[model samples]
Target: MPEPQQLEAYFALTEAVSLLQHQVEQQLRAEGGISTVQFQILMALNGAGQLTMTQLADGVVYSRSGLTYQAGLLEKAGLVTRGPSPEDERATLVAITPKGRDTVAKVLPGHIEVTRRLLYEAVPAADLRRLRDIMSRVRDHIREEPPRSAAPRRRRTS
Candidate 1:
């Protein structure tokens, strides 16, 4: 286990991230009928034009099944559609519909405003830059590390 100071720092950072996520999610939910995860998936599709389900799952922090469920719901809502992949018939591709794009356009401005107010307005430009640099480095380091044996695996157990 980490020492007390290390644990405290971890807790504090985790809480901060959670709070930010919650706030953003609440704002998105209030404006759109969709959750932040759904909004993110839409945004990814809008940005990328089209993506495989696996690509969408990687773009967002969603489990494959969870993303599929969300995509199914979105499809039923007329917000997105899945089609056969052009490059690989075996793979499926997901894309945002015009309705989805319009919905995202309607909500994106408010989302950006809230993000700017919560993050940018509160920090000095230099500090924000430094923070971004530090976070990027940390993300790279973690991604480069081998999967830890002790890491929790997502599997059902009887």
Candidate 2:
């Protein structure tokens, strides 16, 4: 069992993350008509220009089927496009459209403001530095597991 202080720290960290995610989800839905996962996918595509379905699944830490569903929604909304990759026939490439870029640009400022106001405003500069370092280490440790893309898929039921 963890010490009392360690348990408190873990709980606090989890609660903080949940609250932050809620705020971000609300903002994304209101401002961009997109969910947090969709926003993540868009941002990833925007940054990387284009990526395979596997790449997106791995980068977003989302399940392959869920990513496919969200990507379909995005494509329907004219925010992204899905196509076969030239280099690999087996791969499906995803790319953000001009509309997608515009949507991201429109929503990004509010996202930044909300993040800064909610997260940054509460922490001192020195503590923020420590938080960054600690979180980075934690993230690296957690990511030592095999990536989502490498995980096995569930078998279909009859």
Q: Write the per-residue lDDT of candidate 2 for residues 46-100, one digit (tens) a residue.
A: 9998899999998899999999999999999999999999999999999999999
After superposition on all CA atoms, how large is the RMSD of candidate 2? 1.2
The superposed Cα distance between candidate 2 and the true structure at residue 59, in angstroms, equals 1.1
lDDT by residue (tens digit), candidate 1, 6-56:
999889878978988888898888887788889999999999888998788
Model 2 lDDT vs. the true structure?
A: 0.95
The runs of at least 3 residues in candidate 1 whose Cα sits more than 4 Å from the true structure, single-residue gaps closed, are: 145-158
Q: Which pairs of residues collide in model 2? A: none
TM-score of 2: 0.95
| Candidate no. 1 TM-score | 0.86
lDDT for predicted candidate 1 compared with the true structure: 0.86
Give the TM-score of each candidate: 0.86, 0.95
